[model samples]
Target: MVRFLWVCIVVAFCFSKWVDGFVQYSQRGDPKTEIINNTLMVSITLIRGAEAKGAVCLDGTLPAYYFNRGHGSGANSWVVHFQGGGWCSNITECVARTKTQFGSSRYMLPETGFTGILSFKAEENPDFFNWNRVLIPSCDGASYSGDSENKEAQLHFRGQRMWLTFMEELMSLGMRHAKRALISGCSAGGLTSILHCDKFRGLFKKSTKVKCLSDAGFFPDEVDISGEPTFRNFFSGVVSLQGVKKNLPRFCTRHLDPTSCFFPQNLISGIKTPLFILNSAYDIYQFYAILVPASTDPNGLWDNCKLNLTNCSPSQLQIMKGYRNQMLNLLKPISKSKQNGMSVTSCYAHCQAQYQVMWHADNSTLIGTKTISQSVGDWYFDRAEIKVYDEGCHYLVPQ
Candidate 1:
């Protein structure tokens, strides 16, 4: 059944602009009603603080977010999600991103219907339907970590300041009194969640229940098919360019290079806060963007396979299988954390928690009888014990 759905998804990937649509830029694209329900008025809050002095987007626009106040019993509870867009490692890439939604508030949508964990409907988001939800927009072109300002490039790489100011603003808005809090993100945003989990917990009282979730964010620091140090080189540039070494967790930086610290595999074991990692063994973005980037495949050996998985040769699939094994192996030690939770399944999709269809459906992405929504909800609410680490072939589900 999963295989059949995978075939359909591969067809869609081949026929449609799947890569463009799923890129972090769309801010978690889910099916939207043509008119965009007028009742859902999401006002944008611009940045403000001493740290935000030069904390602007790549396009020189102020960062913003959508805040939905909770009602009834959920007023004291909070759920904050950091938006995800791929990072820019160089001045050239950041300049290009400035023209797009990832780096410019001018391109962000004024009105967006919340779905997945942000869904107002109780059926779609049972645990957090009424929680005070905050969506932190991604426009820094970094994973919300950087403090350098480039006057010549006309860019303010102050993602760290932006994150600090954003959190401070949330605390001023009554989040300091939160009884239960969850910080989550997808893709680049997911990395942000992992990076700031302990800092977020520190903001609240010890009695407060604070946790984090990273969706499709466990990027492995491994070599691409071409055996080149693609991500290392890219991250090395980003770290040096953005002055990110000082911003990283000191414990990690003390042991490893700043670029290596960015990888979850190197940083996960040191995290003291409770965390939940939701990732696909065969993450679509990593496969194309990192594993076999255009630079690694100048001849386009993976062009057909990337667009349509069904077209992949046996050797290509073998490499992908190896990638899956690496993910599982990296996760082995983190699995022992009693406070941590995970759902590392064999799927080709990215950002599972953002879409309504993938979060929970009749044929939703799952490990055994548990769907992503069910497992995450249980972990968050402490309703049930969750230890899901499925050892099987990757599965695909059509949206």
Candidate 2:
């Protein structure tokens, strides 16, 4: 049994017109259809940034796509997705693949018709580029979470945080159409979904709603990625637990890490943005999984790939330990409030990007090792019992 962390892929390329930069993948779900059905994943390009069409931006063009399975038509709504990688380039290919697959929000909506904010990676300009699609401030990509702090690339770390804020701002800017607004992230990104939920809550057409599926963002409270353990990091160098206790009010889950919003803690009690959390049972995916699993009742967690990921590279193994710890710590109740209710309308992996679900040999473990408690399928309509599937490639069997 392998505990698969859905946070996974990437590569560097020349930013040339011939640079047809794109990612390819397939998503799986277990939906029960009356018969066999084929819903073509649609692409709705919300903002075609004129800059994307320029040579400076990319000798070719920057194309961002948001994939959707449309619903009934109305105001063209959107859901901005942030890909998960430890704010580094190690998994650039994986994250890029996702962006290429489902970057646009309106592409697959239930025909209710929606629009997506899209972007293309300028292989040369991974550091920065013009927003060719509707810039949701949500600049998507992954970064290395390694402890080595090279002075030359500190700018990348700084920009990672700022870009997350930028994406939330972008979502707020264009949230005028949707009936409600939601922020979702997987793995470390699951942390982003929580951190930005409250930040973007009131600014949109509706308050930010969150669906946290398998996440204990890198820093629940800021642990000095430099050396500090999670406890002290929560206090931002305040080594004294007494100091942390004193700052309990300010120490809410979201704010525990001075660097991140208290997304985990705030998602449930303090914030009104309804949140949904899913953790697998009998699985030790993260160090936190050792702390928190199905509890007495494991629900949506299909597989705990962390424990099973022994063969993962040193980088992957360490990532599993850190995130698992974050997940367990996060699973603990902040104020003791139960979730409002679970919804069936969930996307398994972070499919909010375009051209997602790349199940190639090198990265196959990234998806298959994880298991789902419920049946899985794809391109199907979801309602109250919407199934949120992550990783895993095989097309979902109609439940």
Candidate 3:
């Protein structure tokens, strides 16, 4: 217990205006041939975020190994995979740069990550099934970077800015490939799903592409973005940023703003975008940590209840709401509901030799064919281990 509390304290203390981390993955950014028998994957490096500095984080392309099993003139529905990082974070950058900075040290994505969502366990999911992953690049805090009192200012700004650019860039790429595409992210990235819904629609429609699938990025609704101290200013230091609020739209978020502001209503309402929200029974990290309930934009849910129901069947809405409710209650005062990392470690080896649980799933994308204006929303948690039961190889995904 002391150890667990210690880790939490460290995380909370580091909660500064904007704590940054970086990773550079060199996998091909392209899925493999065997996996190609499943789906086509294409990586649309958005080319935005932290660009104010003018220097591209890294020029080299990372390889993505996908498995495809669909038919198309290379024009199939695509899924844009985003990894988990609760915004204001650098987990992705850290992962991508593991080899460069750490060098084959104990930093590469361990085989365990592939074996299960949790680094060392396999109970939440039996077959670690996540595809189309991105080493979530660095985020931008825009101009709201001053007030140290309110940490969200920075987190919200960074998420809004980074996600908007991601959507636009993804839309531009989907324009020439699949019928539609999927947009997904975990933690803050999932939050990105709801916030950027509006902007994504306009761009996709303009290109005549498809809609988005927002996984568990939903937080009741946003109230007001304006807070006591804005995080934009604090973020300026990280991106070689310049100017003030006046520089916005024209210079700043022009490439960073999520569709939330311009659209008002969560984008889910405006367009008939299909979204698949998945969350864990113990996803308190997002619920308790990120959700500033009173502050979430109210109009955010404006689009959800009306106008967009034709496609969002009752079943879909029910499923989404159910998980969201579970999310709400569990996160009210969010604490690590999942088993503690320490508990997972063997206590100097149990008296008897006990087998540990390992859950995993594999996914692949094939961009072998090309279509235009498409997307797939398949964002989900890396895996939130609610309770570390010794369950083995069970299919958690619905069949």
Best by TM-score: 1
The TM-scores, one per candidate, come to 0.87, 0.39, 0.36
lDDT of each: 0.80, 0.31, 0.30
Specify the highest-lDDT model's number.
Answer: 1
The collision pairs in model 1 are none
Q: Give residue 105's lDDT in candidate 2 (0 to 100).
A: 30
Better of 2 and 3 by TM-score: 2
lDDT of 2: 0.31
Question: Tens digit of lDDT per residue, candidate 3, span 291-389?
Answer: 322244355542342223334457645643454454444333212322111011111111010111211123211111100001111112213222221
Which segments of candidate 1 are over 4 A away from where they belong? 1-41, 48-52, 391-399
Which tens-of-lDDT digit does each residue in 1-399 have in candidate 2?
122322221122243312321221112321111111222223333333433322010011222324322122312333444444332232332233233322213222322111122222223111111122221222223211111112332211122333333444354444444443345444445555554455545555433232323232323432322233444233232112112222122435445443232234434455445444443311232223222233411552323432234334576446445654454455455313343322121122222222212211222223223222111111111223322323333332110
Query: Tens digits of per-residue lDDT for model 1 on 263-323?
Result: 8898889999989999888788888777898888888888888776778899999999898
